[model samples]
Target: MKPQRIFITGGASGLGYSLALICAKGGWRVCIADRDIERGEAVLGSLQKIQPQTIFMPCDVTQFDDLNAAATKLQEIWGGVDVVVNNAGVAQVGSISDTPLSDWQWIMDINLMGVVRGCKVFTPLFQQQGHGHFINVASMAGLLDVPNMSAYNASKAAVVSLSETLQNELKPHNIAVTVVCPSFFRTNLGQGMRSTITGMQSKLDKLMAGSKLNAADIARQIMRALDKKKSHVLPHRQGRIAWYAKRWLPRTWYQRLIHSQKK
Candidate 1:
């Protein structure tokens, strides 16, 4: 599709940055969007070393106006996008009782509303073009809940639901939507999560340190999904197994596991 003009949110760092790098190497015209202008430009600089056509635009997925402006600007620059990757997100780790209302709202706005806004703002343009692909980044937590991560779990579950709904809704319009469920990746995700409670910080710190996969590995799987036009992408083997088990087993068993370490 004319080398696929691609726009990616959260493209300044982590999996987003890695995806940007790989796509540029593959000769796709890429525009990366993130809230941090400096980091976004820095990633753009690095990407240009690989593919001189890449560029960066400052954007906050949580802000609807910012998302609209980003879409408008990128559309004007590229003429129209063949792909949109809604990868921007924030994670919050806390039990439902411990998580404040404000924390839940914030996580929902970034993780769930961000994808909604992305589709709302960009889908029309894709419709005008008659074909486009969307890749929404959800977490493995979307498929299964974990202890001390009620807010994150809720947000990602919403993302998965929204993605599935849009996949069916947008099918008639010739738009393909894929939901990405990634397991523990050594991205700045743990470090970058927003937490209202201070006590959970140290625990999250330990979790990040123990992550097995890195951003590059996750990026590769995301690209595979994009190229293959797969509806659901699982970045890690454990993530796949986890989803399978959750699907086959009863909710009580999963709930028991979440409530305690015993399986």
Candidate 2:
């Protein structure tokens, strides 16, 4: 099939922007939905100069009305999107003891509920079209928990479960679902992440400093997996290994690994 239309949440920056650029290069109609209108427009302008077929729509994934409006706007232009990448998310750092209930709620509202809202709004439209794909961006944290990121881990774990469930529910409708579990890739998420307390943990900095893959590289792998209609898109080798180890290891070993830095 020819490149039709792809709508991506959080497409104004980071990995989403990179993915938008990739899809545009492949002759797809790209809609970059984001909460930041200025940033979204800037990305749209840049991509237009390079691709000329990309557009921008302001959308706050946490708000059902915003996503509904964005979805309606998209329908006017493209009728229905062929692919929806629910990638907008935030990481909040805190342990269960130190993490405030408000922080947990906020993190869940954005990271987990954001994907839920997107899927809720778009799946019906996709069904009407009789063909669609949904890509939910989870994290390596979803596969294995790390200290000082209880909220983030929980949100992503929820996304992992939700995505998998949707895959089973939407299979007969021809709407494919992919859950992307990626290890640390070079993205702006580190700088943008919010923490409940200062001096909580420098895990993000440590991870970024040691990260091997770039966002564009991960985006490429994701695109390839989408083309192959794969369900689980692990964009990094380490991610795959981590998943396997978590699955096969004893609870004691997993707990040790989760507490300690060594695998």
Candidate 3:
């Protein structure tokens, strides 16, 4: 039997790279798609040592043409992809009022529309194959409101919403959609993260450094969730707490808790 094939956007580094490692270890044919050709090729070389079936494709998820070409390439090489991980995203740290319009568009284009384009391109292929999974990497900010991350929050929230809708719509077709909502973990996203808030970059760096979970651990959790066919994967303990609190706690209480965190 052929190994299951998995394609990941932003697979050169961070969580996407970790996911690629995990899937390759499981004997899957992993295809990494990223805008950074150099890093993507480097990652492909590393993965080849573990699983020779791995390949790298230069992809910019923000561009539909890029994603379409990737899909076509996958079809030619592997017949079709068994899974597509829409994991390319950028982080923004600023209040909505402080965020520039260009920044908003940039974040949304890569974070939200990136996921949309992946799904739009792959859904048809999945339908033709009669089975597939979409792992969309959202964030805890999508589940709960956080200060100084309005743009990131909005983009992730849109992803969560889109994932939920796709989960329901694709159920009968045997395609699964899982939205991962993880809190801060060690990743390179911080390197390029845009922040208008004073000292926010350093603060974010500290938070990520302090976090116990790493990208590999999160990738394992995502694989577990995918095996169970879960719709949502919250890898962080704090993220789970916040998710439940937002759903079960009163609005006033949740507001108070959020306000207290700002202090």
- Name the top lDDT candidate: 3
For model 2, the run of ten residues with the poorest summed lDDT: 199-208
Pairs in clash, predicted candidate 3: none
Q: What C-alpha lDDT, on a 0 to 100 scale, does residue 261 get in candidate 1?
A: 51
Residue 181, candidate 3: how far off, in angstroms?
Answer: 0.2
lDDT of candidate 3 vs native? 0.92
TM-score of each model, paired residue for residue: 0.92, 0.94, 0.97
Q: Compared with the true structure, what per-residue lDDT tens digits does model 1 show for residues 1-263? A: 23678899999988898888888988999999999898887678789998898988889998899989978887788888988999998888766787789988888889999999999999999899898999999989898877778889989999999999999999999999999998776676765776656766666666556667778887887777877878998877877876777788798876665566523
Comparing 1 and 2 by lDDT, which wins? 2
Candidate 2 lDDT by residue in tens digits, 1-263: 36869999999998899899988888899999999898887778889976787888889998999889878988988787899999998878866787789888888998999999999999999999898999999998898877777889889999999999999999999999999988876677856677767753475667766768877988888888888989988877877876787899998887787677734
Q: Roughly what TM-score does model 3 have, to 2 decimal places?
A: 0.97
**How many residue pairs collide in each prediction?**
1, 0, 0
Candidate 3: minimum summed lDDT over ten consecutive residues — where? 1-10
Which residue runs does candidate 2 get wrong by more than 4 Å?
196-202
